[model samples]
Target: MQLIADSGSTKTDWRLIDSKGKISQVKTVGFNPYHQSSEDITERLQKELLPQITAEIETIHFYGAGCFTDLACQTVKDALKNIFPKSKAEVHNDLLAAARALCGHQPGIACIIGTGANSCLYDGNKIMDNIPPLGYIMGDEGSATWLGKQLLNSYFKRWMPKELRPKFEKRFSPSVGDALENVYRQPQANRYLAQFSRFAFHYLKHPWVAKLVYDGFNAFFDKNIVQYTDYQQQPIHFTGGVAFYYANLLRQVANDRGVRVQNILESPIAGLTLFHQGE
Candidate 1:
């Protein structure tokens, strides 16, 4: 049996596949390395992820957020090794999984829009170069978390319409208490705030929300992606919960930037499964 994990800033997807091209179980867990300590990761893997792997796992491929650094990857590799003693473990960044899911055996640019955002240039099966992922604090425009933050800022600063103010207030009950607690005292605070992006989904047709979405995607393309001079004419592919949900808006944004997007996959599991089968 082989294990493959794809973890984002919010959730993780774990797949256990056999040589017979059969998948036994796919489990999900909340284990974002950015928000959790090493001890916390170990505890969660032991209790939540390892129990599902009842067989003799042969290989493990872990592509996760916050595992970009060599030290971080080694730490996760060590942790998985202790759990799946017989398995050969390798850890990498989640962006590679996104690239594989989006481009597969074809060449293209891949981007992830979730709690945070990131993009990379892929030539068929391998990533050529990555446009520095700035995480949630520095960049990550077009991400659900960033959208939520913008919405909150607009609401609090009275930048939104007067009529929408009451509705927004009623929905979020915008008090200093809720904002502070949710933003500062929560794990995966970006994801916590990103939940509000769904609310914006309902109002996306609204002019203000439309403009906001446009601006978010525009910022993403302009800052991290637009500078890729070599891939200017290449097709762009996207994956992540937000990209899947707001594909129309994303496509429009891409068109405005004079770029084309070929695919928008919600999860990379299907692509990974296909890849493993061919292998």
Candidate 2:
């Protein structure tokens, strides 16, 4: 059996595939070397994952957020090796997983818009270039966190419609002060911010909300996608909750920018399964 994982900051999707192509799946809390220690990851694996496996694993392909550096990748690899000592393990950054999953053996541009956002240019087999994501603080233009930031800014400044303010306040029950405290001096601020994107989705019919979504996507195209050579000719693909849920809005933004969207997957686990199975 082989194990494949597609992970982001919010959650992980795990697939167990047997030699005959039979597959089973499970979910666990997300792991990031920058945020969680090796011990923390091992404990979660023991508690949430190990018991679910019914077969001996042969290899483990772990693609995750924050595994961008060798030290970070080694940290996760060591933890996995400690548990499944007999299996060979490979740890890689989530971007490669998105590229493999979205582009496969075809060269194209792959983008991710989940709690955060990122984009890369893939040459059929490997990433040719990448624009720094810079996380939610400095960048992450079209991500849920970005949208949430915009929504909060509008709400706090009372820039949204007067009628919408009461509804927003009632739904979240957070004043501008409370929201500021969470964002400026709180843990998991990105996740906290991303939670509000649901509000944006719910009120998408509102002109203000529509404009916010469009402008955020436009920023992503201008800053990230447009920088690549022949980007307009490449098939643009996406994999993440934000892109999957708001596909129409994303496509609209792409259309306005004179680009085309080829695919949008809610998660990459299925494609990752196929990729690993072929390997």
Candidate 3:
């Protein structure tokens, strides 16, 4: 049996696929090496997550946040190896997996616009280049985190009209202190910021929310994507929660860049299936 996991800041989607192509999917708490403690991660896996398919896994591929460095990947690999003694485990950064899911063996630009954002150029079976996803601080434009920040700022500064701001505040309170504290004091600041993004998701067409989405997407294109001048005209593909949830804004941004965008997959599972089946 083969196991594939796609992880982001908010959650991980686990899939177990047998040689006959039978598949099962489960949802687990997110595992970001940058945010989660080793013990917390271990507990989550051993207790709540791995038990779902530990009995069936023979080989595993984990694509997740904070597995970018060799050290980080090794840590996760070692942990999984301990859990599934009979299984071979491989860990990789989530961005590479997005590229794999979107580009497969073809040359194209792959981007993930979700809680965070990243982009890369895949050159027919390999990632030829990547635009640095500098996280939320220095970058991650066109992402949930960025949009959430905008929403909070707007509400706090009274830029939003009282009619909506009151409702927004009642739901999330738009407090900078609470927002800053939650992100800094917890293990998953990215996740915290992402939670705030749900407002835009529910109200993307709202004038205020639409502006945030547009600005955020435009910033993402401006920072990491526009640098790929060589593949500017190539077909671009996207995958992730935000891309799936907000297809219109994503498409608009792609059009603005003069690039043809194709296939906005909601989940990586379909692409993962296609990849394994050689489709």
Candidate 4:
């Protein structure tokens, strides 16, 4: 049996596969060494994950947000090792997962636009270069968090149309004070902000909303994708909730930029599953 996991800031998708290709899946809260302690991860695994295992696993492949460095990867590896003591475990950054899932032994530019965003140049089997994502605070231009921040800024500044303000207020009912508290004093501020990006999908017909989406994606292309040497030649692939939901807007931006989009997957787990099976 083999275990595979794709984790982001919001959730983790776990898949268990046996030799016959039968599969079982489970979901758990996201874990990142950058945020949670090793003990917290251990407790969550024991409580949320242990009982789901019906067979002995031989190997575990974990690709996750914040597993960007060896130290971060080791933190997760150690936790998984404690839980599945007998299994061989490997940990990798989520960017590699997106690369393998999107490129599949072909060269391409793979991007992730979720709670946060990242992009890398993949050459069949390895990442050749990457522009730093810098998370939601510093960059993450096309991400849900970035879009949400835009929405909040517009709403707070009374920049949105008078008609839309009432609807936005009614849907979220977040007062300026409440919003400040959540962003400044709370944990998972990125996730909190990202929740609002859904509004763009619901109210996409509004010109302001459409423009905001275009601007955000344009910034991503200008800042990250355009930096690559052969960005125009390579196929651009995207994976994550943001990319999947707003694909039409993304494509519009890509067309305006004269770049072609190859694929947009909501999550990389399915492709990762196929990749592991082939191995």
Candidate 5:
């Protein structure tokens, strides 16, 4: 059997595929070599993942958020070796996973727009170019945190539509003082700020929300997508919660820019499953 894992900051999705193509699944806390130590991953593997599996895994494909560099990938590889010493393990960056899942063997532009945003130019079998998504604080335009940050700003500044302000106030009684403390001093500030963007779905028709999301999409396209000389010709594919949820707006933005929109997946797990099965 082979194990396939797609990990992010929030959680990990594990799939065990047998020779007959039967697949079993499990979940665990996310692992990041950039943030967690080998020991941390080892401990979590022992406590959370070991007991859940019945198949003897022969190969492991791990795609994670922080496995960009050789050292970081080695950190995760070391932990996996410690846990499943006999099982061959491979570590890769999540961007590759997104590309393989979204574009498959076709050359295209693959993007991720969840808590953060990232995009890469996929040349059929590999990433040819990438625009760094320097997290929520620096960049990550068109991401949930990006959208939410603007919503919070407009709400606090009294720029939110007058009709929706009271409803927003009643739905979430946010305080400016608490918001400042959370954003400046708390951990996972990106996640905290991202929560507010969900309100846009409920109020999609509202001019204020529509404009905010439109502008966010435009910013993302302008900064990340258009940087590539051939971007206008390549079909763009997205895999993330924010992109899936705001698919209409995303498509509309693409239409306005004259770019082709191919696929928008809620998460890459399903597509990854298909990819590994084919392999």
Candidate 6:
């Protein structure tokens, strides 16, 4: 029996593969080692996850956002160990999770463009290259948060088309002060900003909206993809909401850049489960 979990900034998807190979699942709010302590995670696991499992077994594989450094990874590993003392626990960053899920044992470029943005050059078995994903405020250019931030900026500054302003106002009805407070003073500001992307999704074909999406994706490829040595030769794959939901625009940007894109999955959890099952 084994447990597999894939976590991002907003949610964690858990899969328990029993000895008989049957899988049971659960979901909990996401945790970042950068934000939450081991005790906080343990408490949630005890309250939310422990009740869902009946068969306790061998190992645990936890891939999480914000588990970027050795200390971050250890923080999660300790939390997992505390929850299931007898089980062997392994912790890794979310970028590695995307790599393993999207590329498997084949060499390729893997990217995550959901709440956050990150990319890696994977050489079949390991990540050979990675561009550090700075936060959404400055970097993370291709993520949902990036798109939302752009949309908000455009709407607030009246950069969007004249007619669309009313629609935007009607939908969100947010004032400049309100937007500022949400972004500058509120918690989970990333998620708050990312929500505006859904509005963009509804108006995708609008010339202004399309440009916004395309420009962000163009920046993504420039910063994350073009940095790789064999980026042109490597099949680029993505696993995240932004990639999956805006596939047409993302692919268009890739095509314009003369790069090849292979797979785009909404979540890496399913493919990650398959990968771990094979291992």
**What value does the lDDT take at residue 201 in candidate 2?**
92
RMSD of each: 2.2, 1.2, 2.6, 1.5, 1.2, 1.4
Q: For each candidate, what is the lDDT?
A: 0.80, 0.90, 0.78, 0.91, 0.91, 0.88
* Candidate 6 ranges beyond 4 A from true positions: none
**Model 4, span 150-252: residue lDDT tens:** 9998899989889889988899987789889999999888889999998988999999888998898999999999999989999999998888988999999
TM-scores, all candidates, are: 0.90, 0.96, 0.87, 0.95, 0.96, 0.96
User: Candidate 6, residue 106: CA error in Å?
Assistant: 0.9
The residue pairs that clash in candidate 3, if any, are none
TM-score of 6: 0.96
> Who is ahead in TM-score, 2 or 4?
2
Of 2 and 6, the candidate ahead on lDDT is: 2
> Any idea what lDDT model 4 has?
0.91
Candidate 1 lDDT over 1-279, as tens digits, reads 878888765567877788887886566675555566667778878988776766788988888877878888877777777777778888878888888878888888889987789998888878888878676767899899999888888888889888777878878777767887978887567866787777678888788888888899889888877867666788898988788988998899888778888889888877776666555
Q: lDDT tens digits, residues 1-279, model 2?
A: 999998776688999999999889999988999988889889988898899987898999999989999999998998899889999999999999999999888999999998899999999898999999888999999899999898888888879888788888888876777887899998988988998889889989998888898898899998999999999999999998889998999999999889899979998889889888876
lDDT (0-100) at residue 89 of candidate 6? 94
| Global lDDT of model 2 | 0.90
Return the TM-score for candidate 5, rounded to 2 decimals.
0.96
lDDT by residue for model 6 over 182-278, one digit each (tens)?
8899988888888888888899879888888889889998887889897899999998888999999999998888887999999999888888885
Clashes of 1: 0
Indicate whether candidate 4 or candidate 5 has the larger TM-score: 5
lDDT of 5 by residue, 51-155 (tens): 998768899999999999999999999999998988999999999999999998899999999889999999989999998888899999988899889888988
Question: What's model 3's TM-score?
Answer: 0.87
Q: Candidate 4: misplaced stretches above 4 Å?
A: none
